[model samples]
Target: MRLVVFDVDGTLVDSQADILASMVDAFAAVGLDAPARQDILGIVGLSLPVAMEALVADADHARMVEAYKGSYAKLRLSKGASSSPLYPGARAALDRLQAQDDILLGVATGKSKRGLDGLIEAHGLNGMFVTRQVADFHPSKPHPSMLRAALEESGVETADAVMIGDTSFDARMAHAAGMPFLGVGWGYHAPSQLDGARAILNDFSELDDALNALWTD
Candidate 1:
């Protein structure tokens, strides 16, 4: 079976507004100035502690992480998950891929298992992915541990797997794991930053075509 692994935030879902807002609140709660929006967006695919470290110097990393999680949860409760919507055509692409018996879906994300679980349930995507790798169980993006675990759990070869995401972190992780990477242009990082991607897709409509080409070629 061909394995298709996806990244969560900024890739499958556009959670920029909520992420940035919560980050701002997290920093504020800790009596610190928040990083710029662009700075926060640049680190979207990283685990919270690592991202927090980059955003705040010499602060209590664990406390910031907890504060960020609490702030994010509170924001979600108030604004609802509606603030983070699936990009146009995302569902269609997933549907088409899921219908193919040879294509097995998986997720390798920096989100916690709880966070990823909520997202899948919120989107009614239960049981769609055969493997779920989260930050809770592995090192952050670009470390290749998550992708490695995903491949091992799914029993899929690197040559038969492809990583789809929207950031350089994802591309780097895929490359490090010896998996082909396909990047989406609509996410956090710039298309230019996706240097190692086999192809940079402009829209979800192009996903299948790109995947097909990757597998065939």
Candidate 2:
């Protein structure tokens, strides 16, 4: 069987607006300034601490980090939570992949279990994914633990797997596991940022072609 592991945040859903808004609110709550939208979105694939580190240069970044978490959690739990929406054609692509008997679908993301669970369940996408590797269960991005765990859970070999995401981090993880990496253009990472990816697509329609070309060998 062919295993297709996807990144949830950018590849499936366009949560950049909500993510940036929440970060801005979090910074405001702590009396600190938030990074610009472009800057924040640039670090989308990294874990919270890593991303924050990239934004703050001061020594008191730890404290700011805590405050940011407080604001982010609160916002996610309340009003700003449901602002994220799936990218156009994401559902159709997933549905098409699900109908194939030889293909398996799963998720590998930096989002915490609670957050990912809420989003997946809310969109009724739980059944479409067989395995999930989230931040709560694994180390941050660039680590192979999450990908390894997801593959283990899905009973798939590294050779049979591919990672579909929008960030270089996702491509890096796939590289660590000797898996093919496909980058998306309509997501958080700019196309130029995904230089190491095996293939890059501007829209969902190109996905099947890329996958077929990769696996046909």
Candidate 3:
């Protein structure tokens, strides 16, 4: 079977507003200013502690992580899926892929297990993924642990699996795992940053076409 692994935050959904807001709150809680928007976005695929360090080398990462989690939880409860809505055409593309018998869906994300579960529940995406890998159990992105776990869980070969995401982190992780990659242009990273991607799509509407091209070639 062919495996399709997706990244959460900036890939399937657009969570920039909520992520930035929570990050701002987290930095404030730690008595510091948050980095610029682009700088924050650059760290989207990293674990919370790593992201915190990247944003502030000497800041208290633990406090910021908790503060961000607390703030995000509150935001999720108050705003629900509105805080991180799926991209346009995302549902359609997902439904179409799920209908296919030869493909298995999976997720490799930097989100905590609770956060990923919340997003799944909020978006009614329960049972959509055959495997879900999160930061709670694995190293941050650009490491192969999560992708390797997804492959092991799905029982798919590297040659038949493609990691779809918006960040350089995803591309590097896929490479490290010996898997192919497809980049999303609308994600936090620029296409220029997506080095070694087989193809990049401007939107979800081209997802299947891109996947097909990647696999058939």
Candidate 4:
């Protein structure tokens, strides 16, 4: 089976507003200056601790992570369900891919299992993924641990899998895992930052054709 692994944050869902707001709350809670939005988005796909480290520098990593999670959760509760909306055409692309008999969908994301689960439920994406790898179980992006686990779980070879994400971390992770990378332009990082992607998708409408091109032998 051919496997398609997706990154969650900036790839599938446009959670940038909530992410940035929660990050500001997290830093403020710890009496630290919030990092710039660009800087925060730069570390989008890494594990929270690593991302926090890059943003906060000398702060208590554990505390910052907790604060961030709490602040984010509070924001979600207070702001209603509109915090993260799927990018345009994301659901359509997923539906199209899911209709294919030979394709097995999976998720390799920096989000915790609970976070991913909430997203899936909130977005009505139940049963769309055959494999799910999250930050709770593996190293952050560019490490290949999550990708490797997803491939093994889905019984797909690296050569038969493609990593779809918006960050350089995602491209590097796919490279390390020996899988092709497809970058989405609407996500956190710039298209230029997604080095090694077979092609950077400029529009979600182009996703089906891009996936076909990458998955073709």
Candidate 5:
């Protein structure tokens, strides 16, 4: 059996508006200016603490993290699943992939447990993932801790698993875990930055062929 792990933020859903809004609120709450939009996008796959630190290393990261979560929750409450709608064809792609008996679906994300669960529930993706790795239990992306834990829990070797994500962080983490990496073109990072990805999928519609190309090699 093969394991397919996905990154949530940019890969599965387009949560950029909520992310940017909450980030602005978080920084404002702490009397700090938020980073530029591009800069914020650059850290999409990182945990709150890590992202906060990257934006403003000297700021109150703990407070900012809490503020970000609070703001995000409010936004989610007000907007519902539309705030982070699955990209066009995302659900269809996921359904197709999940239907494969030999493929096990999992998620490795920088989102917290509550955040991940809420998104999954709102998007009607409950129970779709076999292994859920959240930032609550891992160091951060590019660390390989989350991917390693997912592999161990699934009883799958690194070679039989692939990490699908939208950032260099995901590619780096897959490399660290000795796993193959697949990148999404519509995510925050440019396709050029997805170093070491076996393939870069332009859209969910191309998912099957991209995976086939990667595994066929």
Candidate 6:
């Protein structure tokens, strides 16, 4: 069986604007300045704590985490999760993949299970994926554990699976898991940053071709 694992935030959806806005709101709630979008984007795919470590040099970790959660909750509770939306052709691409009897769909993302599930439910993608490995279950990106779990959960070997994402972290993680990486160009991370990827897909239209080629190999 061929299992295709995907990253959520940047690979299938564009949530940067909402995410950045929420980060700014979090910083304001804590009386701190928000980091630049470049900095935040650079740390895409990392776990929350890891992202914080990359962006904040002097802030107390625990305090900042609490503040961020508090502020994000305040905004998220009232905001109705308007940030994450499927990218153009994303649904079509996924449906095409699913139409193949040999292909199995799964998610390996840095998002929390609640967040991931919420997005999937909101977008009516409940049954699109057979398995999910969220941040709540494993260490952040650049670590092989998450991918490993996804492979295990989907009952597929790393060699038979492909990882699709939008950051260097995802490429490196796929490499670590001994799987092929397909980098998405329209994400927060630059395509150049994923130079080590098995292939870089410029958009959803290219995604089907990339997957077809990868599976054909």
Could you say which candidate leads in TM-score?
A: 3
Model 6, TM vs. native:
0.92
Q: Tell me the lDDT of candidate 6.
A: 0.82
Could you arrange the candidates by TM-score from highest to lowest?
Answer: 3, 5, 1, 4, 6, 2
Q: Flag regions of model 2 displaced more than 4 Å.
A: 59-82
Q: TM-score for all predictions?
A: 0.97, 0.91, 0.99, 0.96, 0.98, 0.92
lDDT of 4 by residue, 60-148 (tens): 88888888888777766675547788888889989999999999999999988877887787788999999999999998888999999
lDDT of 5: 0.93
Candidate 3 off by > 4 Å: none
Q: Considering only N, C-alpha and C atoms within 3 Å, which residue pairs clash in candidate 6?
A: none
Backbone clashes in each candidate structure, one number apiece? 0, 0, 0, 0, 0, 0
Give the lowest summed-lDDT range of ten residues in model 2: 75-84
> To one decimal, what is the Cα RMSD in angstroms of model 5 from the true structure?
0.8
- Stretches of candidate 1 above 4 Å error? none
Q: Model 6, residue 6: displacement in angstroms? A: 0.6
Candidate 6, after superposition: displacement of residue 111 in Å? 0.9
> Tens-digit lDDT track for model 3 on 1-217?
9999999989999999989999999999889988999999999999999999889988778999999999998989899999899999998999999999999999999999999999999999999999999999999999999999998999998898999999999999999999999999999999999999999998888999898888878
Q: Write the per-residue lDDT of candidate 1 for residues 52-130, one digit (tens) a residue.
A: 9888778888888888788777766666558578888988888999999898999998888877887787788999999
Worst 10 residues of 3 by lDDT: 208-217
Predict model 2's lDDT versus the native. 0.81
Q: How does each model score on lDDT? A: 0.88, 0.81, 0.93, 0.88, 0.93, 0.82
- Looking at model 2, the pairs that clash are none
Q: Report how far off residue 213 is in candidate 6 (Å).
A: 1.4
| lDDT (10s digit) by residue, model 5, range 137-195 | 99989999999999998988888899999999999999999999999999999999999
